[model samples]
Target: MGYFVNVEPGVNLYVEDINPTGSKTILFVHGWPLSHKQFEYQFDVLPHMGYRCIGLDWRGFGQSDKPIDGYTYDRLADDILAIVDALQLDDFALVGHSTGGAIAIRYMSRYNGKGVTHLVLVDSAAPTGFTKDTADHFLHLALNDRPKMMREVTDSFFFQYATEEFCDWFFHMGLQAAGWSTAAVIELLRDENVQQDLRQIVTPTIIVHGIHDRVIPFSQAEEIHQQISNSQLLPFYYSGHGPFWEERERFNSLLMDFI
Candidate 1:
């Protein structure tokens, strides 16, 4: 159920499609320095519930092709469009996390939410990008010592206890990405703002953010909720930046209810 779809010449993205013929379809886009594999917990259960779960690794991350350029939000969103066309996906729920959430917002506005039914943003880095200082710090760390940066990010990911083994696994996932790609994306997250894109969205949207999120604070989520006329914000009190994994059962239940 996993394969690669060509987004452009010499650029193919890795996709994990489970329950391909299920009654409903949900397309997932992962965050920075991670792959579609980040949604392993959701994929494990949603497929059994008769939902077709499709997760794609954007270019330069996961098993996807890594090129020297095309890391901008617009280009990344175009990549999603290519997958949508290739799969002939329609009336599907779109879910995105962190930087993936920002890309999802771009996709919705740029494509006018063509085939999307419901939109979900989990601890998204959107409506606004990271501050220049924070971005600079991460960029420097990524360029010089990526492992250290990944370890720091992993440490701030969850509010709940994660085993040492689990933290190592998460850290390695970031390492799988190309260093150049990682730096390029951090730049995009610093430069690109999606407030206007939020206004263009006509799809019913839900913003699921952790109150204790250190990466993208809860205040940003509040701003996202305010900009989208039809959107609602749900705070994860007992979670940090990764409510999806920190509170998987509740996150999955919320998705089922919303979609």
Candidate 2:
């Protein structure tokens, strides 16, 4: 159940759609430096529960077309819109992790949450305070020493113990992305702020964040919960940036309960 959907003239995003005939659908947007594969744990179980799970790789990442431009949040969100239209998806729960959550926010605001029934943000990297210097430093690392940069990201990804094999797998996923595209997204992270977009959301929203998250602090998730009118905050006490994998059972249970 995997295929490519052309989001634009020259770009086609890779999508993994499981249990396509399920009554309930959930669309997953993965975080930065990773692709739809990041939801491997969720995909393994959700489909068996009679839920249709759809995950997509952002342009320039995973199996998607890599272009030099269109890394901005607006354009990224537009890509999601194209997929929705192409798949004719309706009343589906939208789940996004880290940077993906920020993109989901943009999609909700920019497209008026078209066909979205529920919104889930997991350890979202939004309401950021990133500066130009931060972006430049990360961009430099991405272009010059991507392996080192990805290793650092992998080290801080989880609070629980991950096997050496797991860490290697995660690190390689980041490396699979185009170097320029990785830098472009770092710049997007530096420039974009979705606080206003969060307020504009009328959809029922859920913010699931790790209590000990080092990348994006717990405070940001709290702030996001406060901004969204119909939102609830669920903190993953024993997790770090990746609750979906770090605490897969609990995360899946919460997601099922919410949906």
Candidate 3:
């Protein structure tokens, strides 16, 4: 079942919890314009592996409240901390994907990872920040033409040869996010590079990326691995952006081993 954790006045974040009684918990933060459902594949497998799994949908994403503002990384990090505090999660692992990775980096650096032990980043954005060309292009699309951004990105970057059924679902999930959120978050992520914060991560870290990822280039993963001391980098050679879905068997196996 899922519960809404209120992070601020009139804002409740949606979170789905599974196997809550398990000894160790894994909190999953999703990428841009998606929700906890992004990790549906993981939830289907992790609970049976004797690990509790929690998935959070930030403000204006998924089933959570979609206000007109508060889409910055700082607020997103606060939302995550609120869930941990509300649920009293302790000694748990944090798994963040894409933009969620940025949020996780901010959360850990600002709070020094109070209750977190292990960290996993999947196809994350680069801490060094997006190139000016890329940032300008994305910012324009986000602010001026969101539907085009959603359709093009969803088709070209999100899925590479996925079945029609899966592709449709992924596209729809992107649509579910509020337009204000989709636009605001793009600018927020572009402007807020967490390079300084990534240096502050003392917890053990592992970075995963799909070699052929177009949305966030694989070079971003290399930069993160280089910045974070002693962090492991795992590249999915045969996969693209969504490795968890593209190479489920290998990803699940690697994740189980990593944990």
Candidate 4:
């Protein structure tokens, strides 16, 4: 099933609610410059594992409404809350990747994770914001020719084993993202401090990180695992920034175990 859930006036978040027969649900939040389509692997495999998978496109990405406002973390959290309430979801696991992980932190902290039973962070950006230099470097890259920028960023950082066809598709997916949200959220990720939010995660959590991650680094995942009272770190030894693509089978197996 698909939904254009109304978040606020003139803003409807696009959500794909797949396989409704299962009793357990997993809500997936995608990373920056990408949409829930990023989790096509999970969506394809998880349903066979008896999971009802729900994927959302944030307001400014994918098929969701691209409003000029409401790009902040707090707004992102509210957008999630709107979906949770709309679906009346309970005892569901919330999975987030990259920037979405930080957004999950904000939601769990601010809302106390009311309907959530478990939390999963995949190569998340949390506990520590990006350093000024690193942030500035990414900002510079994003400001240049957008398509070329996406190609460069994907090649240089996101994947180590991705084929040319995969890279091309990934670049196109990113190019569909709103320019304003892309630029603004980079600064948001760089400047917003989420250590306190990380400390407040009461839900049983698992932090997954690729050992070879150059974009967010593996240490960031360690920091998240260390701070969350009920959290464990799961390392993707042979993967880079995107283990879901680089190591799909292992990633799926670990995720099934968590479920």
Better candidate number, 1 or 2, judged by TM-score: 1
Worst 10 residues of 1 by lDDT: 193-202
lDDT score for residue 130 of model 4: 72
Model 2 misplaced stretches (Cα beyond 4 Å): 129-133
Per-residue lDDT for 1-259 in model 4, tens only? 8879999998999999999888789999999879999999888899988999999999889999899888788999999999999989999999999889989889999999979999999988876657888778767877776676677668855546677898888888888888877877778888786788888888999888999988788888888888898998999888887888788898888878887
Across 1-259, the per-residue lDDT of candidate 3 in tens digits comes to 8888888899988889999887779999998878889899999998998889999888998999999988777788888889999999889999988888888999998888879989999888758445677767866887787777777767765445877787778888887888888878877866778888878888999998999988788888998898889599999887777888888888878777777
Off by over 4 Å in 3: 143-145, 158-160
* Candidate 2, position 147, lDDT: 95
**Per-residue accuracy of model 2 over 125-185 as CA lDDT, tens digit each:** 8777356886777788898999998998899889999999999999999988999899889
Per-candidate TM-score against the hidden true structure? 0.99, 0.98, 0.94, 0.96
lDDT, model 3, position 31? 89
Q: Choose the strongest candidate by TM-score.
A: 1
Scored against the true structure, residue 236 in model 4 reaches a CA lDDT of 89
The local distance difference test score of each candidate is: 0.93, 0.92, 0.84, 0.86
RMSD of every prediction: 0.7, 1.0, 1.6, 1.3
| Best candidate (score: lDDT) | 1
Off by over 4 Å in 4: none
Cα error, candidate 4, residue 197 (Å): 0.7
State the weakest 10-residue window (summed lDDT) of model 4: 152-161
